[model samples]
Target: MTGTHPVGTRAPGPAGQWLRNLTTPPRGAGEPPVRLLCFPHAAGGASAFRPWRGLLPPECDLWAVQYPGHEDRVGEPPATDLTRTARQAAIAAQWLADRPYLVFGHSMGALLAYETCRRLDHLGVTVPDRLFVSGSPPPHRVAAAPADTDSVPHRMHGYEHRTGTETGAGPDNEQHDEQYDDLAAKTLSADLRMLAGYRPGPAWRVPWPVTVIRAAQDPDLDAAAAAAWQDYAVDDVTLATVSGDHFVCFTRPHDTVRLITGAVRR
Candidate 1:
């Protein structure tokens, strides 16, 4: 864990302010050897990863990406363009390029992380040392749902009814949280629309190591879908499975931390 300067207390410069606004540093007192930038799934915010700070290795620092329209940035409008969001995230993460860093994203966030890497590559910026994608299939393999389909929150509510359960329930419950407010629902719909319309170019390849993590019983992503991630990696691709459904990061935090640390240490 690495210490964060007091919020709003960074030096007077664009770069300093960017760091202050976009990233939440680890809680310890010194900079760690490597940085891990964690991106959240649709309708999720940086606070979703708050538990990880204590579980990750001390040598690694955790920085969660705070997208607009969620958590403390709730007043800002959510981004609907995947390319533009990726470009902005790449630029915001540029400050971490001075050190070895890896990018970790779950579900929709996996796609976002991949696109950010591509944007960084296009800008000749330092590419991530590794990319860890959890519970998402390769970009090309993802089937586009109709852009006007039921939004994630609506789908989540339906799942809740079917299961006769409440939001934020345990491992046996549906992976999605059904407690989203109106604003979250609207933001998630926009993100889903972007995801539905996104189609990666054929020549694109992640020129670094990739580790694909799958939830053992994830309904949304099966073994074949998880394995398809190899198609987008130019280097080695390791597939690992953990216990739980799509929200394993929340349901199996210890296992998630172990898997992540193992991948980072390798």
Candidate 2:
């Protein structure tokens, strides 16, 4: 079922605002042939995919999920349960289920995207055409990292520095650190705790194709790890390698966009 409503048409009032908050604005002019629902890494928000709009095909609209306790939703409390978060996301995105769309997630976001697909299936909504998992291993293979070992602020600092270097924004410093730390620390801590406790149940194969994107320089995930995604996909499972590390979504936007568009077109 394709989306019959034209682009920019949405319900009015508080309900509209709530749905709008979960998605990024469409960068395309007309109704897109497909929608790309993007999910960010841990401690990251929809803004992480803001740079992707310019690189994507004009026929493909990008909608980045804005989880609670981040970005514009900063006023809300962080979610502690992955199942609850995925359920909420599935509900928020139900309006777009009739449209041809795909889900793209990086790292922690990959898990969320997959879980959300499951919820959509249970709710009898249209599942995505494909599931793109980047910079993450399969659910069963994922083991929680040691908790509270890394400071939220410090991680944010490093992320900012890496992003700056990749975008030619120059070197990040104490100033940037101070600015984002307070806004992100508490929320990030809560997110980390949530992540630590998450353990995927026995394999439940998805009915759609799964595309795994591996970063060549990403120390955390290798080819073998990415290949494990096959266990979760009953359909085709393809692995594509790109340059850069875990932050390849930001650093290699063009390549990332190319891979995504290619998958959709196929």
lDDT (CA) for every model shown? 0.68, 0.71
* Candidate 1 lDDT, 1-266, residue by residue in tens: 01111332222344342233222353444664677887778766665665676787767777767666655555677677776787788888887777788888888889888888888888898887889999787787764434435545665444334333123443355533444334456667766777787877664678988888898977667989888888788976989899987776854578877877876643
**lDDT of model 1, residue 242:** 90
Q: Candidate 2 — which pairs collide? A: none
- Model 1 error, position 123 (Å): 2.0
Which segments of model 2 are wrong by more than 4 Å?
A: 1-32, 144-148, 151-156, 164-179
The true-structure Cα RMSD of candidate 2 reads 6.0
Which parts of model 1 have CA positions greater than 4 angstroms off? 1-32, 143-151, 154-180
Candidate 2 residues 1-266, lDDT tens each?
00111222232343242233222453433554677888778777666776786777766766777677765566677789877888888887786666688889888888889888888888989888888999888776765445443553464557666665222233545444443555556667777777777877667788888889998987667999998888898976989999986787786688888888886642
What is the alpha-carbon RMSD of candidate 1 to the true structure?
Answer: 6.2
